[model samples]
Target: MSNLERDPQEIRCGTEAGERSEVLAGREVPLGGPRAMKVSRTLPNVHRRMIGAWCFVDAYGPEVAAMRVPPHPHTGLQTVSWLVEGEVLHRDSLGSLQRVRPGQLNLMTAGRGISHSEESREEVLHGVQLWVALPGDRRHVEPGFEHHADLPVVSRPGFTATVVMGAFGGALSPATTHSPLVAAQLAVDGPAEIPLDPAYEHGLLLLDGEVEPLTAGPLLYLPPGRDALRLSGRGRVLLIGGEPFGEEIVMWWNFVGRSHDEIAAFRKEWMEGEGFGVVEGFDGTPLPAPALPTTRLKPRGRAR
Candidate 1:
């Protein structure tokens, strides 16, 4: 899903301090038009720009609506699409067309650059759209897409976890990643103790039902160190974590880059129809890049 905001904020994201836990609540943001579908944006919070390399996160739906997001460009990041309900048809510049449903994954690597469109194939949509800032060494590798219909699942007494991006309880996802990270969807039954990587900082977002000590809106951030997450309740939640990103990033609109000039160049290419290849199949025109902020963009480090 695109950032769709007419005046999107320029986010300077950095690594986590690896100190204590924090709870970041999401704010409601509309996706498109007047009667837009609203999503709760949890990452890139004023208090925290990122949880490891996980830069942006938007959770939406369980409400009735049709989502139509036109072709939008992205650079220096990978898009991770996961759904709890409904289906989304994805088409991209690489000439890839795939329909993603519950229990499936759509991973797009906007290496140097890539463009894509998303349309709801069902009325009620419930899911999260996330972005991982690629490290400098891998940021310009190549633009690509992956549709994983079968992913590893780890079952415990109180919950069942579907590994979406990285590894969990020895179960690893087939989706390729640039850095050491983890993303999983947990279906909580009663009470459970989930292990954690002492080296990777983590964040948990409750999607539905009730997970004790965790409600259905805010993202719970767990800094690296001693492990294990103990929760008692029945609900659904998303867990994402990674080694604290060693580098800082400048995020504007849909693009992620290092410096102000780098971002400016990306915007120029998108508006001029250059770098990012064209995304066919969508009936509507591509989304226009938002205007740059008057001041130069800067990188901010470790949101302590």
Candidate 2:
């Protein structure tokens, strides 16, 4: 996906959000061809900005459909493919091919640039695809991918949190991260207390059931800087946090850059096949890059 051709439903969150809990709404996208997939997009919204290094979150599926995402490109960010259900075959320009199953974390770093694809022939599939912006130092380090079958988990009386990145509850994930952040999947059957880093900003995504003070519909921004929380419910929740990222990032489509020109240059390179290379063993030809903006693309991010 280039910085161009964005689905219009990817709306920016409204600014008139209430202080306590701003329930978010989602938009539907055809991730796998024509099959509609509901994406609860959380970053770039009006209520809040980046939660640490995470700049984009797209929670899709629980619904069934074969996923076939043609080869695409990404840059300046790490793609976190978290599978809650089903399995996906990942292929990238580095020639890395791995099938990610449920409970598995498939992370791809597009430091400079990378071309890749995700496909699943399974009739029933479900998962979430997220993006974490690379800090200034690691933005152009190199392109890499890692598959982790086992990660650190923190358990309480009625909740279990599997650390997808960073550390929580004295447990650290072996997963590579550029900055201090936490991404965990929490399974809850009843009331349970989960610890938090008081220095980190946090949020909640109630995936399966409702948590007290949080309904099942949107991205719930927790009162930041809290040390711990008692979540009472019978569902699954995704907890993400990080030391507030101080850098301003420009995100368009799948490419994250510091400026519009950088995005423009990358888009041109992708279309001309100059920098971003081709993915080996992909199902079909890679999706063509979208056309560049006619006007000088305006940049969006936190004020630096």
For model 2, residues 1-304, the per-residue Cα lDDT tens digits are 2222344222221112223434445444456455544455655565565667777777776777777778888989999988878888999989899999988899999999998888877556666777888988999978999999998888888899898999988899989999989999999878888898988767788777677756665676654558888889788888888877767666766787877788888878888887767888875877876565565555444421
Candidate 1, superposed: residue stretches over 4 Å from native: 16-18
Stretches of model 2 off by over 4 angstroms after superposition: 1-21, 301-304
Model 1: worst 10 consecutive residues (lDDT sum): 12-21
True-structure RMSD for candidate 1: 1.1
Q: What's the CA error at residue 303 for candidate 2, in Å?
A: 9.0
User: lDDT tens digits, residues 1-304, model 1?
Assistant: 7899888887977754648789998999999877679999998887888888999999998888888899999999999999989999999999999999998999999999999999985388999999999999999989999999999999998999999998998998999999999999999999999989999999999989999888788899998884789988999989999998999899989998999999999999999999999998899999998888988999886584
Best by TM-score: 1
Predictions in order: lDDT = 0.91, 0.74
TM-score of 2: 0.90
The TM-score values for the models, in the order shown, are: 0.98, 0.90
